[model samples]
Target: MNMAAVKLQTSVVSQAGKHTASVIFLHGSGDTGPGLRRWVYDVLGQNLAFENIRVIYPTAPARPYTPMRGAQSHVWFDRHKISQDCPEHLESIDSMCENLSAIVQEEIRAGIPKHRMLIGGFSMGGAMALHLVCRYHQDVAGIFALSSFLNKDSVVYQAVEDASQCPPLPELLQCHGTADELVFHRWGEETNSLLKKAGLNTSFHSIPDLNHQLCRQELELLRSWILKKLSL
Candidate 1:
């Protein structure tokens, strides 16, 4: 795959002063970087803003979605099905991970080290975050996945298990809702369990009566985590 093909367009939320750190957050399927940026401002407001940390929201390339029956959508990867039972489509996944790594590398060249950056997203984007951090950029500062999961027998577990010396996985904050019908809450819990078992610093939160969407409580936790992880 051409690296330039996956170099995505982004919407940035600039910080107040010189940026000391960066947050590269991906949007869910069908959502653009600008759309997610708008939602973050309108819904999250000040909860996710910082004085010296720039937030970059990258838009995925529009492609044919298998689950959506060939409908074109902005997705990090094509999936035949969106359930934990179905295996992940690694062909597109590996490509997207490389794409995300390019973004991280750009940040590195801009003076922000991998250890000073966080990677994360919601739903499908969250799944991409998992692959990007775990399989490609394990040295990142942290990861946050909202209402997301990994496929059965994920390479993440294998990467951890197969390492001769245990890799230094980043701190992870994962939140899921009990009422989520699309991606089941159990899948998120299982993801947390697997990550912890692989010795990652993982934290899982369950929102009662919540669905496949964000809530104030989740954003508050994310803000706290970000402050603790990447604050100057």
Candidate 2:
């Protein structure tokens, strides 16, 4: 793990009216920003082209993924396994998070306040989003994690514990499928529970019989949630 900054390729969905807010959504392992751009619109049933919301989709740099036996993948960070017990690759995680912070800094320079921006993603992307927002960008408007979970020993938990005084934490919205075999429903539940206990305003939604993917209902809820947060 080299700590050198990597510039990620990004696809932006510009705002219609004014650039009052921004949403940076990360893609899961092996997925690119352009790939997620299409899927997001297709799943949400509409482009995120909200009146004042600019959506940025960033592609991860290709790196050797451990679970795939060192095969390269466009993942925000690498890990030994998806289990909560697996140790996180902090070197790569920190390097990638710094790259992501560059994107956030650019938005801030353009006049978007941290409180008017939302960060989120699906699956592995959601995990990275949790790390980024929790460890670095706590002043963000809110965070959304879909079918996602953090490791039991994640730095996010430690960060919360190390805080001398509770800051105004971001509101969190997490949605998981009851039948998700990949990420497991219980993981999402436990993650949400832990965050809530850490004093975050968390809302969890469960969809019956769904699997490791998103559905119309989930996207509908996500769209509404983004709207409400950005409108504030």
Candidate 3:
């Protein structure tokens, strides 16, 4: 694995009135940073009444996605199905955590407070969000994982166990489509159960009659959650 810095393209949407919070959006695999621009306008823009809120969309580095051949896309780390007991998987988890920590630190240096920052993404991006929030060193306002799965089962289990000896975890919102074929709905169930069992504050919603993509209602629900989280 390369420890080289991954270049991230960013787009910021500023609120004209009173600012409340800052949301950092990470896009899914194969999608550019600007791909989530419409989500800012449609979901956050229209829903958030506060003028001070800002939305930051960051693009992941384009890289080869292993296991799934003939594919290259934006990914936080190389995807591999290591043995269930392998410690190698934890190494990948740590790499992602460090990458996200750097990004969060950058956001804080740019004026976003740790308490007012929200991290979220869709698909692979969503998986990154979930992993970061669980293992992050600092506190964030909220976390949203949409159409995504937990990175790996064992790592999450260990994180949960460790969290028991520390302070509370941040609030988490997970949304998944029951009909999703790519990332099966079972992933959502497993993640939800794991997080809940860990005693973290979490909310899970399954969209009916939907597939791998997010539906209009799901987007609306996300918008609402953002507003409530930010108190906008």
Clashes of each: 0, 0, 3
- Candidate no. 2 TM-score: 0.95
Residue-level lDDT tens digits of model 3 in 185-217: 777777777877876688889988688775678
Model 3 stretches with alpha carbons more than 4 Å out: 39-50, 81-93
lDDT of 3: 0.70
The digit string of per-residue lDDT tens for model 2 on 7-36 reads 888999999988999999998889999888
Candidate 1 vs candidate 3: the lDDT winner is 1
Please provide, for model 1 over 11-125, each residue's C-alpha lDDT reduced to its tens digit, 9 standing for 90 to 100: 8888888889999888999999898877766677652678889888999988888989999899999887877777777888888888778889889999999899999998888
Best-to-worst order by lDDT is 2, 1, 3
Residue 228 miss distance in model 2 (angstroms): 0.8
Which pairs clash (backbone N, Cα, C closer than 3 Å) in model 2?
A: none
lDDT of 1: 0.84
Lowest-lDDT window of 10 residues in candidate 2? 157-166
Q: What's the C-alpha lDDT at position 201 in model 1? A: 81
